[model samples]
Target: MCKITSELNDLRRPSLLVDAANCGTEAYQRRRDLRRMLRVAIPPTARAALEKLLPIEADLEKRRRMGATTYSFARHVDILVALLAEARAFRAS
Candidate 1:
């Protein structure tokens, strides 16, 4: 006699389990994957905003390397904040 197993029987597989250490690592990896996907999925305008911001970020790093004054750093910080806000708003649209 031939016997067939019900589909319901296949649903009895073991539950997914994650340890504390691996959980953090897995979450970080997932975030990296999501960021990579977003980079690919961003619209042209959003990508342009990112492109514009990249040089400012690099310039900030350069200024930091050159021991820029606190005021200069603060100004750069404000510019970065505004750029970030503009990018967020553009993406929302």
Candidate 2:
């Protein structure tokens, strides 16, 4: 799977794993494969949200070309930490 797909999988796993109906678990069972989410339902908000990754990907690619080792391992925990912080602020408003 591509890095984008893998990362999206990580982002999706928690809620998606629990929502069998949303994921079309039965329909894609035989065709179970990477990015299977594409074969079934992709949440209405998902497209716009995922489009944000393109810029992030481009930034990371620039870092890659510049030989930045740390960029290769952007930990999800760190991302989640930042996301939670933003989420908290969003909730406050």
Q: How does each model score on TM-score?
A: 0.37, 0.29
Alpha-carbon RMSD of each model:
19.8, 15.9
Report RMSD for candidate 1: 19.8
Residue 69, candidate 2: Cα error in Å is 5.1
Query: Over all chains combined, what TM-score does candidate 2 have?
Result: 0.29
Across 1-93, the per-residue lDDT of candidate 1 in tens digits comes to 111112112212112211222233323332243244234443346435455544555566567667767426444543344344434545566
lDDT of 2 by residue, 1-93 (tens): 655455545543234223532334333222232123234443233333244433444455466457777664333222233223323333444
Global lDDT scores for all candidate models: 0.41, 0.37
Using lDDT as the measure, which candidate wins? 1
Steric clash pairs (candidate 2): none
